[model samples]
Target: MIVKMLHDAGLRSEHAYLGAAASIGLSLASWLASNRQENLERADRWGIFVGEWAPTFFGLGLALANYERTDGEQLIDSQ
Candidate 1:
């Protein structure tokens, strides 16, 4: 199920790169916004947390998808 989700989201290098890039952008926005306001810590926290997760998710997606292709199946490396 997770593999299918990643595949449908275009987990190739191109998409992974995009996801990572987006994550950075979100993180920046989160940080900047967090520093600008005093009553929006939750929003800032949410954005920052989610943003941080994006890069890792995209990176894993890339590695798994590539592994799948190399193995001629959706078999990701266990390393």
Candidate 2:
């Protein structure tokens, strides 16, 4: 129901959480893939650490779906 909260609060799905999900996933994936190149230092390690945020994004997407009105939040919406 988080998404409904966001929506009721005047936030658009595609503009906020949805966009955040895509952005975080892409960033995390790229960071993870790039980390396999060589010995990464502390900063690079931090990058990899930060790259693991994709699942959180996905979870937020789930919350958004749960907040949906129709059919108890269909997961297969027009994503």
Candidate 3:
């Protein structure tokens, strides 16, 4: 139901996928930037924190893609 609402509200699987990819890039960038100014542990923590978001985004993308496919199937079946 939540995925359906998100889809209706203009959130697509592609967007989620892109977000995941961007999160990965951001995580790498943050780690590189923080490593220069902070201790290894702190820099690793920053990367880990940002890296966690990628899985959530990837999950959302999968859910949205499944919802879109099912929704399309329903439409075709109804016709």
Output the number of the lDDT-best candidate.
3
| TM-score, per-candidate, Cα-based | 0.53, 0.44, 0.96
Better of 1 and 2 by TM-score: 1
**Model 1: per-residue Cα lDDT over 45-71, one tens digit each:** 767786887768676767766756775
Ranking by lDDT: 3, 1, 2
**Best model number under TM-score:** 3
lDDT of 2 at 62: 61
After superposition, which runs of candidate 2 have C-alpha atoms over 4 Å from their true positions? 1-3, 12-21, 24-39, 70-79
Error of 2 at 69 (Å): 3.6
Q: If the candidates were sorted by their TM-score against the true structure, best first, what order would they fall in?
A: 3, 1, 2
Q: What is the lDDT of residue 78 in candidate 1?
A: 50
Residue range 24-47, candidate 2, lDDT tens digits: 666666666666765556436656
C-alpha RMSD for every candidate: 6.0, 7.3, 0.7
lDDT of each model, Cα atoms only?
Answer: 0.70, 0.59, 0.98
Candidate 1, run of 10 with poorest lDDT: 70-79
